[model samples]
Structure formats: structure tokens, C-alpha cells
Target: MPDIALVLLAGAVAGTMNAIGGGGTFVALPALVAAGLPPVAANAASTVALAPGAVASAWVYRRELAPVGETSVSALTAISVTGGALGAVLLLVLPSASFGAAVPWLLAFATLVLAYGRRVSRALSTATGRSAEARMSSRAVLVAQFLLAVYGGYFGGAIGIMLLAVWSIGLGLDTAASNPMRIAQVSAVNLSATALFLVASDALRTPLVVATMLAGGVAGGIAGAHLARRLPARLLRGTILTIAVTMTVLYFLRGTRAG
Candidate 1:
């Protein structure tokens, strides 16, 4: 029961971070591990607990979701769902020895992206703005989204930056508008992964932990949504990036020690 409370606290922090910048699982994932779950099970549990928070935050930003276009949204959502299913299968079937070894590198990549991703994204947007040849096709954008969604479902650290970078570079959208679409798209991936994990793993089906963490996520999402319209976002996002980087490094060290 105390462990579940700890999970809820982790979810609250994660939910707030996700609402501001994404990568909330960096916090909750380690907390799940500390709570006695294996890494794979922790991933599944984090997915389940955080799913509603994503849905809620996306809905709260529904106005931004509009700019994505209905056709593009449908296409991207379908691809994300497919990719997420595949990722879930990979989680369930892959041996922990290999996957565990891979986690640190994945975290490293995500950390790098989150830390300097906005500047790189801004540079690409600026370059695109200055040149006619910088434009990208819709097919390319969809493909990028599909691959990133697959990565998100497999391990959802720093996915927001990757998703937004694709949108900004491929579609020429502004940061604010791209953010909502990223949330919506990733929510689909999370849902698909959560469903698949539930089907594949009985270990993550913890009633008390799931209920508490998810409920806390819902509450935190609401708080984030309420604050989304407020200004000075870059500072908030920077703080989240710092925390995420630290958490990712710690988790990687833990994984290495466990190995």
C-alpha cells in the first residue's frame, strides 16, 4: 500500500512534467523499479498509469490539435497504433539481457534530444523558412511519425522532442501548435502499448498500484491543462528537461548495476 502511495506521488510529478514538456516516465519508471517490479513490468505499469494523463492533456490542448488536419491525424494515429503494438510485442518477447543493455543507449539518445532539441528544432525551422528546397512531403512526415511512435511505445523518454522536431521540420508548424499534436499522437501510442502489454503480461495487472497511480495522473493532468494557457513555458520546459536528464542517467546506472 505504501508502495502504491509512492507510485502515485511519482505519477503526480510525472504528470506535471509531461504536461509541461513530456518524458514523465523517467521519474515514474524508476519509482516502479524501486517498488519491486522488473524493468519490463515497470514499463508496462507506467504505460497503464500514464495513459489517461496523456489523453486528458491532449484533450485540453484540443485547439492546437486542430491544425494537424483530420486526414493527417487519422493517418498518424493509425501508424502510431500499429507501431505501438509491435513495440509491445518486442517488450514481451525480447530477452532482458539484450533489452536491458539497450536501455542505457536509448536513454542517452533521448537525453541528448531533450537537452538541446529545441535549439536544433529552431535552427531547422529557421533554415526551412529561408529556403524553398527545405520543404518535406507528407509521406516523409508520416513515416517519421511512425518510427518515432514505435520508439515511444518501446520506451517513452524524450519522445516529445522527436515528435515535435518532425512536425516542425517536416510540416513547417510552429512550436505551440506542434506540441498539442505531439501529445495527441503519443497518447495513441501509449494506449496501444498499454492494451498490448495488458494482453501479454499478467505481472503488470496490479489493482492497487494501477488505480492509485492512474488516478493521481488524472488529477495532475487536470492541473497541467489548467496551467497550459499560462505563459513563460520555456523555463518550465527547461526544468523538466534537467530533471529528465538526471533521472535517465540514474536509471541507466541502475540498469548497469543490475546487469
Candidate 2:
């Protein structure tokens, strides 16, 4: 099969997984890289291609996302968009090999965060307990959101979980409400970064790959959104966690072998 076909297939899987919860890029990115794209380019390509999926999913859940009235959402979205653009620019400047080398560590970090997310979130909520500090300053949260966006745009693996923990625990929002807000914020990050990537030099050079992936992702995204409400939450979360850990270990082992 053509690499573009493979990318499209992977994007469909990614879109489906992302719509339900997580683990989409964990599947998509590696497949792209394995298909001969460098890590940074793969990251940019995947981000650009899969963004439409995020937007579609967000729209499908608009009732949840549109009504999130938290003061932090707008500021957080703004900073995340800025940070996403910066990340795309950084990818343009950085060496592909450097990005590839860094990916394992980044994935590992994301894995660690996911592994301990529930514990950490619970502890934070308990310790903070609706205190003043629990309601982190808008500026501080924006800065943190920016940092997360940088990582997210550069390589989005389990970024939603990280954002969820921050919004719910640090920002003291309830999980049920924070869910939609997280999706909206992530949608903004993906869209902004995708726009940046679309204009980047290399992105245009690989038009077919980007186009097909986008087409597949958008179609798959629609399917994913519909499936999200039907599947059991526990099963979806478990699948995401399983995929995340498997990808993390694979990357770690590859690094070890290379070293």
C-alpha cells in the first residue's frame, strides 16, 4: 500500500481513538514515522491532518463545550493557540533527528502523567480543597496551558488527560464540566497549530500525504464522535491507557536498542 494510504488508515484509527478518549496519536505518529517521515515532520503532518477530526468531535459535543463558562477557557484557549503556533515554528527550525530523539522522552513523560493522573488529581483536589490557590490565577494557568500546548502541538499523545487534570484539579473545576472545556481548548490548540503547519515549507511539499490523511481523519472523526456516546467510558479509558503504555514501552525499548 502507498504510504499515504497507510497514513490515512492510521489517521482513521487515531481519529476514532481520539474521539472516544485518547491513544489516537500514539497509533498515528508511529505509523507515520515508520512510513519514512521523520519524527518532527511526522508530528507536524499528523497535527495538520488530524485537526479537522478534533474540530468535528468538538462540534459534535458542542452542547458540552459551548456552555463551559469558566473564566479560564478563553484565556487558556488563546495562550494555547499562541503556544501551538510557536511549536509549529519550532518544528520548522529544529532538526528532525533531534525531534525524533526527544520523542521517546516526551512520550514517556506523558505516560507517567497518565499513569498517575487519577492519584495526582485526587490529591490535588483534596489538598487544595477549593482554596484560593486551587483557583489558579488566570495568567498562571495560561502560562501553563501554553507550555502544555507546546508539547501538544509538537507531539499530541494523551494531552487531553494532562489538560483535564490541570483544569479539574489545579483550576478546581468538576470533571463532568471540565470534560467539554478540555475538548474545546484542545480543539483550539490543534486548529491553530494545524494552520501554522499548513503554511510551513515542508507541509506544502507533501500535499498528497497531508490531504489524504485529513480526509480520512475527518471521516473517521465523525464516526468516532458517534461512537463516543455509545461506548462504555471505562472500556474507552482502558483502551486509551493500554495503547498509551504500549506505545511508551515500544519507544523506550527502541531507544534502548539504539543506545
Candidate 3:
């Protein structure tokens, strides 16, 4: 009973974070781990538990969805689904040690991008006398999105923040404007990964825990999305940056302890 409550609380907080920016895995994964699941199973379950939250958040932002650069929302979502499924298959078939070791560095790099991406983009545009959007080809943007979707499926930590960072840096898209698409793409990744896990993994072994988390996730996701829509753009960006920095540092510390 106590464990269920804890998991429920964790899911709520995680869902809120995911809707607001993206650091939910930092909360969900550990909560599941502490609830006595093995690490790999816990990771799978965390993804499963959060899948609905991503979808709910995406729904809340459906009206605001926009094309990413030259790519339509449909094309981007397809790419995310494909890459995410592949990543999930890899997770089921291979050892994750090598990939796990690299996660901290990846988060650190993404955080840096989220922090200085627009400023850097502006400076580069001024120097090159070219708009930031003109500097990155559509093909490059698609490739980057695919790669990030793969990462999201394998072990999503701050994938929403990563998407914002990439679009902001590569296309000079405003974070607030890009958020709806970010949530939608994240939904694609999570749904794909969750489908794979449901069929191939033991993520459903604890049905009650999963159900509790799912309910909490849905509630929190809706509330969080509405809350985010009301926040000022500067405040939203600042919140995202703070979460990104905090998650990156925590991941680095975790890696150090593991090492």
C-alpha cells in the first residue's frame, strides 16, 4: 500500500515535469527501482507508466502543433515512431551498459544546448550573415530528430528539453512555440516504446503499480499542460533550463557513483 502511494506520487510529479519541460524519467525510474523492481525492468516499467502522460499532454497541445522546419508534424512523428521502435528492440536484445555510460554525457551536452542554444544561434547567424534556419538543412533536422527519438526510446531522461535544444539551435525555433510539437513527438516515442515493452518485457508484472501510476500520470499531465500554457514564455524557458541543469548534474553524479 505504501509502495503504491509512493509510485503514484512519483508518477504525478514525473508527469508534471514531462509536461512542463522533461525530466520525468529522473523521478519515475528511481521510484520504480526503489519499489523493488530490477533496474532494467524498472526502466521498462517507468517508460510504460509514463506513456499515457505523454499522450495526454500531447492531446492538450494538439491544437498548437506545428511543422518542424520543412518537415510536417506527420513526417516527424513517423520518424520518431520508427526510431523509437528500433531503440526498444535494441534494449530488449542487447546489454545496456555501454549506452548507460554515455547517458550522462548526452544529458550534459543537451543541457548546454538548452542553455546557450539561442544565443549561439544568434551569434552564428550574425557572423555568417545567414538566418539560423537557412544554416541547417531539412535533411539534417530530420536525421537529428530520428537520432534523438532513438535515444528517447532507449532511455528518455530529458528528451523534451533535448528536442527544444535541437530545434532552437538548429532551426532557431522558439522554445515555447516548439513545445507542442516536442510533446507530440515525445508521445510518439513513448507510445512506440511502451508497445514494445508491453509485448516483450516484464513491465506489466506489477499490474497494480502500473495502473496507479498511469492514473496519476494522466491527471498530472492534463493539469501540467494547462499550467504550462498559462506561464510567461520567459518563465517557461527559465523553468526548463533549471530542470535541465539539475537533471544533468544529477545524472553526472549518479555516473560518478556507479563508476
- lDDT (tens digit, per residue) of candidate 1 on 5-117: 89889888787767766768877788888787877788888888888998998888877665342236778889888887777777778765665566567666666655555
Model 2, residue pairs in steric clash: none
**lDDT for each residue of candidate 3 in 55-107, tens digit (9 for 90 to 100):** 99999998999898888888899999998898888888889999998988888
Residue 112 error for model 2, in Å?
4.0
Regions more than 4 Å wrong, model 1: 67-71, 107-133, 168-174, 236-240, 255-259
Error of 1 at 118 (Å): 6.0
lDDT of each: 0.71, 0.70, 0.91
**Candidate maximizing lDDT:** 3
Better candidate number, 1 or 3, judged by lDDT: 3
Question: Quick one: ranking by lDDT, best first?
Answer: 3, 1, 2
Q: Put down candidate 2 lDDT per residue, 1-259, tens digits, no spaces.
A: 6787788898898887667655577777777787777766777788878889888887887776532323545667788788877877776776655665776776676566555655666676677675534456666677778888886776676677667555544544544345456666777888888888877745545677777777888888778877765656566556545666776777778778888
- Model 2, residue 145: distance off in Å is 0.7
Name the candidate that leads on TM-score. 3
Weakest ten-residue segment in model 1 by summed lDDT: 128-137
Better of 1 and 2 by TM-score: 1
Show model 2 residue runs off by greater than 4 Å.
34-36, 66-70, 96-106, 124-135, 168-177
Model 1 TM: 0.82
- Model 2 scores worst on lDDT over the 10 consecutive residues at 64-73
